[model samples]
Target: MRIVIAEDAVLLRAGLVRLLTEAGHEVVADVDTAEGLLKAVEQHEPDFALVDVRLPPTFTDEGIRAAVLVRSQHPRIAVLVLSQYVEERYAAELIASRRDGLGYLLKDRVADVDQFLESVGTVGAGGTVLDPEVVSQLLVRSRHRQDLELLSPREHEVLGLMAQGLSNASIAANLFLTESSVEKHIRSVFTKLGLAHEDGGNRRVRAVLRYLGYPDPGPGHPSSAHPSHQEFRP
Candidate 1:
């Protein structure tokens, strides 16, 4: 795979370059500033970009802004953003881009090299990948919302795993349930959240996250209005 890295810290940038290089992936461009990162993406058009959520020249949300721009402009290039904190707002914005090939992970997760690489691969392959910590924080922050309150305990478990980018098969394995059972739970989650079951891929995930109060800032995205709540008959 080809990758472009956008990180301001010298040592960490060097480490990422070495790691990706050693993993048999080519690092097409290594840049320090958000502007430079955008330029590199335009020039290289790498398969994936590893971006830090904060960048030089104010360091607030340059990286995230650049990531969203990439999704809007390039669309084909996958992005995995690294953040020092689990900023739910930033995560929501990135997901609001409503693109598949996106990931948000805490910088601390880099220590687990294997899992980090797995996340990279997953994003590169056009899948959404959210850090477990990010998912946990979002769950806690939105637990009081009525949409979330509508879910059963098991459905809540499945929704959390789904937000972590787990497929039905993986969620089933983790929950010690059959894949069919996991699918049923996921359907129940969508129905309770007032999201259409036919809305597969990232749209469904975004709807669920929006219902969780992350608030998709995407243009024309639906507001958090629930369909008439129906009892879970199973």
Candidate 2:
């Protein structure tokens, strides 16, 4: 697939190009600024694009803003956003577009090359890919919502770790429980949240995002160092 990358960090940009190329996908274009990145997409019409959450000028939401614009102008092109830290507000804005070929993952996740590649392929195939951390953030903020208030503490813990992008094994390790127990907690959380039963996949992300009041940003805005609610980020 032809992919465009928009990231301000030169080293990481080059590293991504090299990695994707080695994995046999074409890196059609790479740019450091959101404007240049958007222009490249307009020119190249790549199959998908990887955008950073922050870019030039404000260094805040420029890249994300660009992605939103792209979604409006080019619905067929997929986008996967990378961020040092994700905000529920930003996630809401992106998802609000109603575009399916989207992803929002933390930058640290890039270190897991295989998983990163899988995410790339996933979006390229028109699937949504959300970082578990983003999912966790959504769930925490939603707890205040009347529908989610009844979750047991154990179920809440499972949901939080799941949002952190932990596998059942990892969740089990963190909670000092068996993998089967972890699965049980997940099922309980799912049922309590009134989510449909399926393979789950990115639906979990979407449900949690809606629950957290993403586009609205809930109560107050907090820096990455401090989140308004603890359940969302842990």
> Quick one: best lDDT, which candidate?
1
Residue 156 in candidate 2, Cα distance off native in Å = 26
Q: What TM-score, to 2 decimals, does candidate 1 have?
A: 0.62
* Candidate 2 error regions (>4 Å): 145-234
What are the lDDT figures for the candidates, one per model? Answer: 0.82, 0.79
Tell me the TM-score of each prediction against the true structure. Answer: 0.62, 0.63
For candidate 2, lDDT tens digit of each residue in 92-167? 7898896589999999999999999999999889999999998887666665365557778787777667666577
Task: Give Cα distance to truth, residue 119, candidate 1, Å.
Answer: 1.0
